[model samples]
Each structure stands twice: as C-alpha cells, then as structure tokens.
Target: MSATQSHRGVGSAVALPPLSNGPHRKRLGLVALIATFGGLLFGYDTGVINGALRPMTAELGLTPFTEGIVASSLVFAAAIGALSGGRISDGWGRRKTIILLAVLFFAGTLVCVFTPSVGVLVVGRVLLGLAVGGASAVVPVFLAEMAPFEIRGSLAGRNELMIVVGQLAAFVVNAIIGIVWGDVPGVWRIMLAVCALPAIALFFGMLRVPESPRWLVEKGRHDEALAVLRSVRSEDRALAELGEVENVAKEERESQQIGWRAVFSNKNLFRILLVGIGLGVAQQLTGINSIMYYGQTVLVESGFNESGALIANIAPGVIAVIGGVIALTLMDRIDRRKTFILGLALTTSCHLLIGFASMMLPVGNPIRPFVILFLVVAFVGSMQTFLNVAVWVYLSEVFPLHMRGFGTGVSIFFLWVVNGFLSLFFPSLVAGLGITGTFFLFAVVGALALVFVVKQVPETRGRTLEALEEDVTTGAIYLVHKNQG
Candidate 1:
C-alpha cells in the first residue's frame, strides 16, 4: 500500500479497502448509535448528581459526610462493576452484557427516583454505578470490535461523545428543573428519573444490533462472527477480516494463557496490563471527575451564588460536548500518543492557571469566580478534546482479544476507584485547602501524569487490532520508543 492509503489506517503497512457504500455502512452507523446509549446513560447518571446533590441534601437533611457517602457509593460500586463487567462480557457476550446493563440502569434509576432515605439512595446509586462502570468497560470495546480498523478510533470514540452529550443533557436538565422548580421539594428525584428513559431505549436498541465479531471469533464461533461482520462490513472485507481474526484467535488459544493467568505468565501481557492500569489511573488523577461530580460546589466556593453556580456548571458541560465533537473528528487524523501528550500538557497548564487565579484574585475580588469558571471550562475542554475519548479508545484497543475484557475491566476498575475516592473527598480537600491549594495540588498531579505519558505510552494508531495485539504480546511496541531514541 502507498503511504497515502496507509495513513488512512494511521500507521499500518496494510491499508484497509474502502468501505462499500452499501446498507452495511448504514447498519454500522445504527449499531454505533444504539450502543452509545450506554454512554449517554453513563454521562447523565454521573453528571445529574452535580446539580441534584444539593437539593437531595436539603430534602434528606444530609451532612457533608453523608453527602460524600451518597456520592461516592455509586463510584465505588462502579469500580466493582468495571471489574466484573469485563469478565461477564467476556463470558456472556458483549451484546448480552450491554443488555443486562440496560436493565441495571433502569432498576437503579427507579431506586434513586423513589428512595425516601439516604440509605435507599445509596442502594440505588450502587445499582446505577454498576451499570455505568460496565458500560465504561464494555461499550468502547464493543464499538471497536464492530468497526473496521480504518475508522476504529472515531467509531469507538462515539461512546465518549455520547457520554459527554449525556452529561450536557444532565446539566441542561438540572438547570431547567432547578430554576423552574426551585422551591419544589424532591425536585432532584425528577432529575434522576430522566435517566430511566434512556435505559429503556438502550435495552430495546441493543436487541437490534449484532454481537461483536471479534468476540464471536474468540469463542470459536466463526460462522456467527462472519455473520455479524457481514452486517457491518462488505462481503469480501467481512470474509477477509474474519480470517484474520480467526488466525489471531487460534494463536491465542494455542498459547493456553487466558485471562489473569495470561497476564501473569507472559511478561509482555503483564506490561500491557500495567500500562492499561497506568493510563486509567493517570486519566482519573487529572481531576476531571472532581469537576463533573462537584462543579456546583467548586463554583459556589469560587464566588458564584448557589443558583448562578447551578447555571454556570452547564458551561463546562457545553464545552465538553464541543470538545468531544472535535475529538471525534481528530481521532482518525491524530495519533493517540500525541493526543495524550497534548491533553496532559493543556490540562496541567489550566490547573496551574486556575490555582494562581484563585490565589491572586482572592475571595472578595469581583472577577474571581468568572476567571476561575473560565479556567475550569478550559480544563474540561482540554480533557475532552485530547484525553477522555482518546484514553477510552486506546484502552479498548491495546489489550489482546483473549484478555481484552479482563484487562479493560481491571484498568477501569482502578480508574473508577481513584475517581470514587476523589469524588468522596474532593469537598473536604477544597474545604481544607481552598480553591488555590486544591487546584495547585491538581497541577502537581497533572505534571506527574504528563511525565508518565511521555515515558510509558505507546503509539497504537494506524494498526490493526490483531497487528497491535501481536506487537503488544511480544513487547515489540516498546521497540518504537527505542528506535525513536
């Protein structure tokens, strides 16, 4: 293949053939749309708490400690969900696991919307958290497995976009509800209730989509895998791709190291697992979720009144959507490593600026809140554009098929764990350290994240999953760095 053709595949020597302008393309688009509803739910469920928490706190007479427990419970449960979801999807099939998650989303939403006490709310949140974490682990992998390598990044990235869109939707819904019914008791329940509609949609929508072809091949179901592939790919491409996948699956099976054992027995697999965990941890430590879960609190501390802060929280949600759109456009055009490097750098700079602005402006300054808000918005934009979508897509791609579910689950488990702890203690951190000290702490962490990316992250763009798998399993991916030096 010429360089031009191969560039479409990012860096692969073998270029994929042009997709047929057939119904298969439309089918692929439909599948992506339906599957991304899982992401939408993930976003809405997580972000709704940003605005709803205060109202719920008032209704239930929650203390800061109880509020933290209510908020962190879902996140902590999600950590468990991510771990189990991966294993379940690996055994139960991706499509089926998603369907199960849809059920969980619905059940959890009901629990939250109707719960009379904090205890019941915590129970609800845990259910929702499981669904959210499962979606986090499974959705991107499902998308990647369904897509051709040529446009895999964008395809997989659509879930992240949906996630942000869902978050934006939550912010918008929360603002409208809070503003329109500011005096109404239990209005936060309405905010949570909105999540149930999408859960219903995802359940029915997933029923119409085919299972992941790569996953089917992994289970030795060649005919079924081919059928699924044919629905999304052209006739010749489906056959060829199936053959390639089968070859890789055969090699994986013959090696006889699967799941955690594969990771432990093979040095390369273990290294990749560590890399996956590192990426997940690094992404969370950037403090993005701290804002997502508690933007209203941050804004109030910065200087905005409660209502104004509720409204202003929408700004980050809006920019996040915009950034996600731009990221989807760039996913195929830019290399994954470059995106990580740039995202970390931009986010770190924004964190430092936010800290310094808070310090210089102080509490009484008229412009302190606006300046801080603008910096927070900038930080979110940088994260969505450069890191969030890219990290999810890369995690979905890096693991070999045999261990993909386990690997992604384990990695995102840590991601959610870190996120849960941060969400739990962020309010306390800010109360103790104030905005300047808190953000300065984030800045320090962001700087360290940058170093980790530059040192350890590898380029995965422009390669087939199977090709990438070969490189990852054999440790040849590390050679790229050595060769560059």
Candidate 2:
C-alpha cells in the first residue's frame, strides 16, 4: 500500500490519481504530530493526578470527601470545557482554539502548583479541566479534517495513542519520584509541573500547522482551504475533497441554518448526534477510567500495600500504551463496528472475571490482588485497542461539517459528565461494595452498552468524511459493511 506522490499545486482544485508516499504524507504526519500534543497534555494533566492525589490529599489535609471533590473538579470542569470548546472551535477555528487551550493549560498548571488552599487548587483544576475537555473534542476533529480518507483512521487515532503515551509517562514519572522522594511534602507539585512542558510544546507546535481546510471552506475561505489541502494532500485528491466540501457547504447553505435549532429540528442530524452521545456515554460506562483515576486504590484494596500499589499501578498504563499502538495499526485495516463489538465483548468479560475472582478469593490470599490486577489490565488493553480509538474517530467523523464541532462537543460534554460522576463516586463504590460488587455492576452496564453498539452504531471505516456526512444526513449509514473475504 504505497501512496503515490506528486509535486503539484495543492491550491488548485484539480483531480489527481491516488498513490501512497512522498512529501504529502510527511506534511500530514507533521501536522498530526503537532496537533496531538494537545492529546499528550490532556493525558498528562488527567493521569498525573492519579499518582499525585495521595500526596496532594496528605498535603491539603483532605478527607475522603474532600479527596473526591479535589479529584473530580477537573472532570466537572471538563464537561463545561467540552461544550465551550466545540462552540469556540466552530466559531474561532480549531487551530486557534487549541492555541488558547494551551494557554489555559499553562496557567492552570501554575495555579495548581502554587496554590496554598484547597479552594485555589479546585479553581486551578477547573481551568486545567477546560483545556483537557477542549483537547479531547478538538484534536481528533482537527486531525480528521487534515488527513486523507485512506489513512484518516490511523492519523486521527494518533491522538488516542498520544493520550495513552502521556498516561504512561505520568505513571513512570510518579513511580520514579515516589521511590526516590517518598517523603517529600510537595511531590505532587512536581507531578503537576510536567504538564506545563507539553502545554508550551502545543502552544508553539500549532503555530506551524494549518487550520482545518474543511473549516476554511465552511467559513467561505475556499482558496485558503485549498492551500492547506495542497500542502498535505495530492493535487487531485485535494481538488476532489475540496469539491466535496463545496458541495456539502452549498447544500448546507441552501437547506438549513446550522446551530442548536438545526441540530434538534433535523431528524437525520439529530439521530447521528444521538449516536455520538451513545458512544460517548457507553465508552465511559466500561469502568476503564475508574482504573485510570484510581488504579492504586484498586490494587491496594485487592491486597498490595500502599507503596506496592503506587508502584504497581503502572501496569495498566503500560498495557494502555501497548494497546494504543496496536489500535493505530488496526484503525485503517479493521471495521469500526467490529472493533467496538469486540472491545465491549472483551471488556465485559473482563469485568465479569474480575468480579468472580474477587468473590472467590479472600483478601488475605496473596493471589487475590494479582488476579484482579491481571483482569483490570486486560480490560484496559481491550478498551484502548478496540474501543477508545474507534469511539473518538467515529465521533469526529460522524457529524456534518456544519455541526461537526457542535455535535462532538455536545456528545463529549456528556462523556465528561459521566466521567466526572464516576470519578466522584468510584471510591465510595469500591469502599462499600468491595471489588466484587463494583465489578459486577460494571459488567452489567457493559453488557447493556454492547447491546447498544450492536444495534445502533454505524460503520464509518472506508468512507471519506464528506461521504459519511452524505450518508448520515440521509440516514443510510446505519448498515454494517461486510468484508468480501
């Protein structure tokens, strides 16, 4: 599968033949790398707290109640961030909006690092949360718009890959710091500081990247859109894609106005939006994030001591990174529907396995913690490889260009809300029900989520975003694509 290369004016809307390789791929890769720094910061900011929370709790004199509040503040803020980010990107353009998010990320990190009181820390977390939520919604959409259809899945999925990589880095950093400076009073501040580097990186990196070409077309800057597409796409493909964008834009202009009213009034658009919402909500229901946020707690409850659990919590993060790599490889090759169905199947089974293991094994038994951890790691791997990338990519591509940002924002806002609720209540759930009851509940919810995907989710695997928009608006995208093999 070599991509054919040509040196031609990308700014001209001329049709060209398809081939793999060359400068176009390089430019696209560079753009993806830069844009995905947002994902790295998102991952780092969110995961840093997983290990930092214990130290932060001690330093802040937090109770279990205050601990939940501290931990969930960012998540609650993220919900608002997702909604506002969507509107900002739609109004201000994705590239510039990311630049603003970088500033917020930097400022928020400083606030958390320098804060003397819990109230100040909460304010800081909310600011950081806005950046995280914005990144989560915008990065994938930005990449999706930039990438050629042939490889859009893998390229867009890079954001998820970077996210897990960021988590892995946090885990490693926390482990090293925890081992060496186990008694340090302000170790959490150092953990929070690591996020600032990526924030600075993203702020500068985006300067070199072009705005989304489709977005330019949406805003009536067709010439600038062509220039951007030319830099990253072959002359022929750029023209073809730009033509598609024009047609869609023309259709949108003729048919309806785009906003909250259009989204709710149009049945097709509303249905697709509901699908995005379902995917967002269903992904979080798997309990993957609970492990991400509180891996140490789960491990300690299973059997390991505090120190052992802190160090041991890195296992899931490692598996998450590995699984993300595998997912990127599979993204363009596999059907979206298959990935979701298989992921939910594996994760659901892992949940059941964890619950049963906890029920059967006594806490004093040495094998108990290891078995539960094994299942948790397996679940995380299944999720990263199959579900996370698929869901994010699908949401980014499913909406019409007019509503892409708004639709994804609304969907992810709910996703963050679910994430916040779980982050807040998970400790209580664990403390009250123990591992068995908690996991069984996840298994039940996962089973239901699997059913939803099997029934309602559409296949977006080989289609261009414009083609997808066409099918989705006509409500023809719900059918599954079967392989000729």
- For this target, which candidate reaches the highest TM-score against the unseen true structure? 1
| C-alpha RMSD in Å of predicted model 1 compared with the true structure | 2.0
Worst 10 residues of 2 by lDDT: 5-14
lDDT of all the models against the reference? Answer: 0.92, 0.88
Question: Could you tell me every candidate's TM-score relative to the true structure?
Answer: 0.97, 0.95
Off by over 4 Å in 2: 1-16, 479-485
Which residue runs of candidate 1 sit more than 4 Å off their true CA positions? 1-16
lDDT of 2 at 365: 98
Per-residue CA lDDT of model 2 for 191-225, tens digit only, reads: 88888899999999998889999999999999999
**Alpha carbon lDDT at 353, candidate 2:** 97
| Candidate 1 local lDDT, 1-485, one digit each (tens) | 33223321224454445667889999999999999999999999999999999999889999888888988999999999999999999999999999999999999999999997888999999999999999999999999989888889999999999999999999999999999997999999999999999999999999888899999888888899999888888998888788778877887788786667889899989998888999999999999999999999999999999999999999999999999999999998899989999999999999999989998997979999999999999999999999999999999999999899999999999999999999899989998999898989998998998888888888888677888888888788878755753
RMSD of 2: 3.9
